[model samples]
Target: MLNKSEISFSFVFSIIVMAELICGSVESLSTYHYFTKPSILISLIFFFWKHAQHLDAKTKWLTLLALLFSLLGDVFLMFVNASANYFISGLLAFLLAHIMYVLVFLRKKKNSKKVLPFTALLLIYAATLFYFLKAGLGDLLIPVIVYMGIILLMAITAFLRQGNVTKNSFILVFLGALFFITSDSLLALNKFYEPLPFSNISIMLTYSIAQLFIVFGLLKQS
Candidate 1:
């Protein structure tokens, strides 16, 4: 059950996410936007930290670390124009974040009897996406492929946790992984393939919701 403070924080969090979406959609991807971008994840970090006190030490650390890396990714991506290295840095940060998420989710039972079908489905989707994106990936092929692998692993682990965690919690985290992958897919499409209409809005919308669901799902584990 949620307390008053948690409820209030959630309301405020929703407002902040909405503001970020609106601002991200309207503003050009300039230095100013970069400076403002970190605010979203920073707020989420606080949200996670505040609620994480109830979690076990290992879970708490993993959750916080994931959020920290995500925050770093947001900051680094902001400076992608200043230096291409920043894009690499951002990629690495998010990669680490996904790794942390996979580790956290995998703490549950590894061999679930019910998850095989979902696992096969996700694997097929990942393979199809890689096939489509491979031609355009060129020099960045290896890193992107590795990133995709980790995220698919993360999503699979989330689904496999069904019996290990609350039903609501599992659903939330699984959807979070789904949206995270969707956001990243849109990002790759825009950068390596043709630009999608309203890519910024779509990517950030899904990305922000992904983080929120993941954070809250983990919080529910406590």
Candidate 2:
């Protein structure tokens, strides 16, 4: 059981995470058209800072690297309006962040049991990418392909780690990653294809759900 101070810290961190989700949702919905990279980077930095003293050494380092890569990703996305290179840079940064997540999760689960399903998902994602490669997303093909590969690895690692973690925490993290993927996929589809009805709403909804699960999972583990 956690002491009063620890519980209080958890509550505060939860609030911050919740606030970030709310802001992210609002940004996505308003179509305010501004990049959310700065705010997201700030939130990640604060999240790591707030929990720095409490995290295990390995977790602390991994989390820090994750945030750093996320910040780079954010900056890369920001350049989307300016140059194609920026978008690629952002994708690469996010890929690195996903790799960092895999490392962190793998540390908790040393054994490898389930890998086939993950490979199938990656193959499917690759097929989807190939289908879209020449459809105005010509320059984005390589970066997006690499990003999806890393994300697939993270999902697999997260799923495997779930077996070793507490039930609630595992569910939270797994579901959170699912929601995050849903949000990103929607955004990508919107960018490459025609916009769907309620697209903004759908993106925001999934984004919030994803953040909620991730924050709660971390807090529970803490």
State which candidate has the highest TM-score. 1
Candidate 2 is scored at a TM of: 0.72
The residue-level lDDT of candidate 1 at 205 comes to 81
Reference-based lDDT, each prediction: 0.84, 0.65
Per-residue accuracy of model 2 over 181-200 as CA lDDT, tens digit each: 77777867777766767775
- In order, how many clashes per candidate? 0, 0
Question: What are the runs in model 1 whose C-alpha is more than 4 Å off?
Answer: 1-6, 27-32
Clashes of 2: 0
lDDT of 2 at 172: 78
Best by lDDT: 1
